[model samples]
Each structure stands twice: as structure tokens, then as C-alpha cells.
Target: MLWAGSKGGLEVRTSAGGATVLRGRFPYAVPTVLKDGRERLREVFEARAFAASVAAGGDIHLLVHHDFDRPLASRGAGSLEISDGDDALTFEATIAPEMRGVSYVADFLGTLSAGLVGGISPGFRVAEGGALVKRDSEGLLRVVRSAELIEISAVTKPAYPQAQIEARNWTPCTAAEDRTLVHALNRWRL
Candidate 1:
């Protein structure tokens, strides 16, 4: 599974669960160990307080979050969506600015799915209202959020399972993603 959050800087955690740890982050850092009894893994970064801000504004996208000490400017456009029953949502996207890249569409859809599925799958699933959806399309995909939707980004693809988890030039969400998610979390009902 994948976990993305930030305590101060930028943090993205993806794990399959085991003693060995695989982690990466923005600002370029090393992976550390994090254990809480049943789960023993490495936590390379913490959730940044401004995480929501960056995400909603599309600060973290299409790049590895680690090894870079400089700031990155937003390069493209995107969209966000949410399922009516809270089943799914497309929280963010970063399609090519020229809008000629159809390949990137697949990656965006996959990332959206990865975000929500990753968020809910691992004990992190918040209440029905705790989720937000975002998507970015440079082509015909026109990203949408739904329980039935199972794709994201035309150019985006999952990293090697056994490779060290790193954030690279993948799609980045807009800061609005956070605001949208916060609202969804607050408004969710049984």
C-alpha cells in the first residue's frame, strides 16, 4: 500500500508490510524505522502541517519528493472529484499544459485510485466524509470519481514493488484538494 502525508516538510510512505522498510520523501531524506507492535516498518518522513496546503495547491507532483533542496513551480492543470456515497473520489491531477499528452491520463487516474485506496485500505480510512477526490486530464479521460472507477493517469504507473519507495515525477494535486477533503470530512454523515 501507499501512504502520503507531511508533518513539516513532505512525506510519502508506501509499504507492503514486513521487517524491511521502504520509504522516501520530499526535501530528500532517508528512511527510518517506525514500529507499533503488530506493524514494524520504516517511516522516512512525517506528515507536514502544510501538507493539505501543498496538496490542494499542487505543490507535490510529477517528481520525487526527496533529494531536492529547491522549490518547484507548478507546471500543469488538474481536476478533483468525490463519490456521492463516499465510495471514491478523484482528488487531484496535473495534466500536460499543452494538453497533447494522452499517455499522462492513465497515470493520473491510477494515482487518484492509489490515493483513496491507499488512504482507506490501511487503518487510515477516515469517516465517510473524511475523503476528497481530485484528477487532472490532458486528454479525453476527463477524470471522474466513482466506486466503479479503477484507473488514474495515462502516464502514471506504480513503482517496482521491491524498490525503495520514492516520489518522482508523478502527478501532483492542488492545494484545493486539502480544502475539498477537509470539507468532505466535516460534512460526511451516516
Candidate 2:
């Protein structure tokens, strides 16, 4: 199992209707160091490494500090959504005040908004024959071509120093409003 922290792509925000949304993009091809027993390896995830897992529609949970006992959202409960993109694995989770009879959602959101939480970390396992290894001046390097995405968590310390989390307020714009805004900008340019 590998827990890879993303590079500055996690966001926590509240919508106008009081729905809290957590969105993240875990970037691929970002090199990070991982410890394997007594050895240290430089690992990079290739593009679409978790394609099969996302395509399979497996349930992946949103947890805190990688703790299974502290799950915040899950795909099985329709609160989580995962997708694989060209350069990253994207996820969006809607968190309500109370879910599944759990009342800690607000507390968690408070901690997150207070800047106490670190960033997003993806827990995954590399598939068989999914990695290529090479040794160079940079020591051992592992290029991961395929993997199974298990869960994404908010942790206190992240392997990637650039990982970040932020809280904001969001409001959705209708399509007609979008077009009107674009048209106004275009007319201003003319």
C-alpha cells in the first residue's frame, strides 16, 4: 500500500445551499519518495495509472489521516465521485452535516477550515507488472503505469510538500448567466 500526497490540488468549500463539497485532483508524474522497509524509492505515477480502478466503479472512501475508522464520505453511499483524467485523478465529494448517523462532519469541516488539516493523500496499490524500475544518478526510480485506487484521505503530514487544502464559499452559475457574462466580456473587448 502506498499513500501518495497530491501536489496542491485539494479544495474544501461550502455552496450557497449549505452543502459542503470537497474537490481534489491528484496529479500524476509527480515524483515523491517512498520508504519500502530499508530502501527508499523515487516513485512517479504515469498518466491514467488508476484508470481501470475508476472504470471498475469501486467504492473509494474519503477518510481523515488515512484512518479507516474515520471515514467522511464513500462512493457506496453516493457521496463520493472519482474520475481519472489525463494528468490527474479527480474526485468530488459532497459532505452533509450529518451522514449515516454520524455527527462529526461539522467538526471535521471546522478543523479543515481552520487550516489544521494538511492535504489530500491517495491510498493505492500498484498492480502486478504495473511498474518499471530503473537506476540512475537519482538512485532507484519506479514508474507506476497502473494501480488500484483504494481511498483518499486528509492527513496532517503529507509526503508532497506542495499539497494544500483550503476552504471557500461557492455559488453555481446557470448556463444562461454564463453565456451572458461571456457576451458582456466580449462586447467590452469590442
Candidate 3:
């Protein structure tokens, strides 16, 4: 839990099946200025919208820097869950191998052993993107609308203040086939 009451940071946890959970502050509410110069707080990915997307099975991935062009982890074999816990949304899913064939799993294991870098973020889209009013100790905010989650990735900096990532399932790539990786890479270069 991050920033529920005071702890302003991220919490990352690791489990079996290459499971990784990223928990922290999300700028679900953002401040925007209207044409009249009035400020409005935009809400992207509120509770309801998030729930629907998960039910719909939106495509999600674990990547570096939230980049969609490439992903480090494959899509989950099962449903992915993003729980709105405390002040953070817990993005939980299993990181799959790039694609397994021959020693592919071994190579994938090597990549995971190297570990990920930076914070966590989610890429999603809003439906109606409506607005709502809410009052808090921080201030009053005109939240725009919620969004549907696409992919939760390991990013540099997310909307809010903090984020963290946790990835489990580590195994050494000691297959005799590893020795032949250089030949494969050389072939790929060609």
C-alpha cells in the first residue's frame, strides 16, 4: 500500500509462475484547465471502468518503459487482475516467456535473471471519459473519466509520485545449448 494515508511510495511483490505485482500511487485523477480557464481534475481508469476491462479481457503486457512496440513478458495464460487497493492499483500477472522453442525458455530465464529496471505504469484507454466531483483533504477535484487498462508495464515514471516492480521465477540458463546462442545471434544479424 502506497500513500493510503501517509506512506508515499510503491510496494512490489514476487511469487511463483513468474508472477509480478506492481503497487503504488496512480494519477487516476489529473488536473486540467477548461477553455474558460477553470481547472478540472481528469480521472483515467477509475474503479468501474477498470473492472469492465478486466472482464472483457483486454490485451495487456509487461514491458520496459510502457512501450507497446516491444514487450519483455508475454500476455498472461489466464486473467489479469488490477485491484484498487488503498491509494494504489495492484497490477498482478504472470510474466511469460518471449516464446518457447528448443532453448527459448532457457534464454527467457536468462533475461529474467538479469532483472528489470525502473518504476511501473499501465497503458489504458478511457470509454466515455466523463467527469465527477469529489472533495478530499488535499483539495476538491473535478475528475474527468475512467479508463480501461491495456497493459501494466515497468516504466520510468508513472502518473503519480511513486511505483515499484516485483518479478519472481528465477532459474539459471545452464543448458549446453546456451553455448550455441552466439551462432544464433550471428545468424539473426544476417
Candidate 4:
């Protein structure tokens, strides 16, 4: 069992998973304002009033202010790279050393993958090296982190579609997948 206590900053204790203590001075806090801002963005786009515009691929108006606490605040943008696809959109964000210890984004992402694979079932293909098989709306092939793959489809779809994908399934990823994910996440750092 994991318990969160407000000791120094935010300390958590787990039975066998080891305790996590977030304290001392850092560039930011764990539950920083940036996370809240991201949540607000998701909420605004999910609002019913913006349905029509969102469906048409129009930009949702952002009423909230920028995340000033972010180290990349001056950049005013995150890293993104994409190539050919039916209609591919790739997003990448660089996390500084301070941000790395902030949250287990990969763990959160893994939970998301389990849910997506559970819902979509055989549609997902977890490659040997930890890449996930993903296809664009037009059926072009691309690989990404499982969680990002899930968000691409799940976040955009009006409703969950039960249809299965036709692609061949890849081998299951192993414990090494976690290491790969961390490397990918901190590519900029390296």
C-alpha cells in the first residue's frame, strides 16, 4: 500500500515498492502549476461547447495563462517531430533534470497503455524493443510509446470504438521496456 504524507514536501510510503520522499529546495514542486495548466487545457478542449471546432481540427482557445514554472517557459513550446502518415501528429517535450524526479510520467503512461490494450485488445502491438505499433487514420504505420499511442486515438475519438486492428501483433515487451521508455523520455538530456 502506498500512502502520501505531507512531511517535508510530499512523501510517499509503499509496502515493498520503497518509499519516495520529495523534499528540499528544487526548481519546482512535484504538483507544480504546469500540471494544473495542462489539465485545464484538456478540460477546455473536452468541453461540449467546443465540440464542432475540435472535430474540424481547429485550435481550442486557451483561456488559461502559460505555465510559468516550467523551465522551457521562454521557449513557449515543447519539442515535436513528425513525418508522413495518413495525418500524423507527433508531440515531444523535453524534461529537465529537475523535472525527471517530479513525477513517474512513464508509470502513469504504462497504466494508460494497459487500459488501452484492455479496451482495444489485439489492436495494439507491443514490439520487442518496446515500440508500440500504431496506425494513423489512413492506416499508415508508425511506432510510438504505448501511452502516447493510446492518447492519439483515445483522446481524439468521440467515443470508444470496439473495432480491432488488422495489423499483425508483435512480441510482448519485457522489463527492459521501462529502461527504453526512460531513455526515450530523457533523450534530450543525453
Best by lDDT: 2
lDDT of 1 by residue, 46-130 (tens): 2231233334443332322211121111223232221211211222222333332434333433454465212211101122232
Off by over 4 Å in 2: 35-40, 100-104, 162-190
State the lDDT of candidate 4 residue by residue for 92-173, as single tens digits: 2232334335444334333334542122111122334433334334332323222112111111111112221212223344
Error of model 1, residue 121, in angstroms:
16
Cα TM-score of candidate 2:
0.76
| Local error of candidate 4 at residue 181 (angstroms) | 31
* Candidate 1 lDDT trough over 10 residues, lowest sum: 142-151
Per-residue lDDT of model 2, residues 75-170, tens digit only: 999999999988888899988755524645555676787777657888765545767788766667778788677789876656656422121001
Which residue runs does candidate 3 get wrong by more than 4 Å?
Answer: 1-49, 74-76, 79-81, 84-87, 96-117, 132-144, 162-190
| Segments in model 1 whose C-alpha atoms lie over 4 Å from true places | 1-40, 44-59, 64-90, 94-97, 101-190
Ranking the candidates on TM-score from highest down gives 2, 3, 1, 4
lDDT of 2 at 4: 67
Better model by lDDT: candidate 2 vs candidate 3: 2
List the lowest-lDDT window of 10 residues for candidate 2.
181-190
Show the colliding residue pairs in model 3. 43-144, 45-147, 130-144
Query: Mind giving the per-residue lDDT tens digits that candidate 3 earns over 1-190?
Result: 0001112333545556554443444433333221122333222224343555555654555545444454545445453455653244555544443333425334433444454333555554333333455655444444434444556655433333332212101112234523332322221100
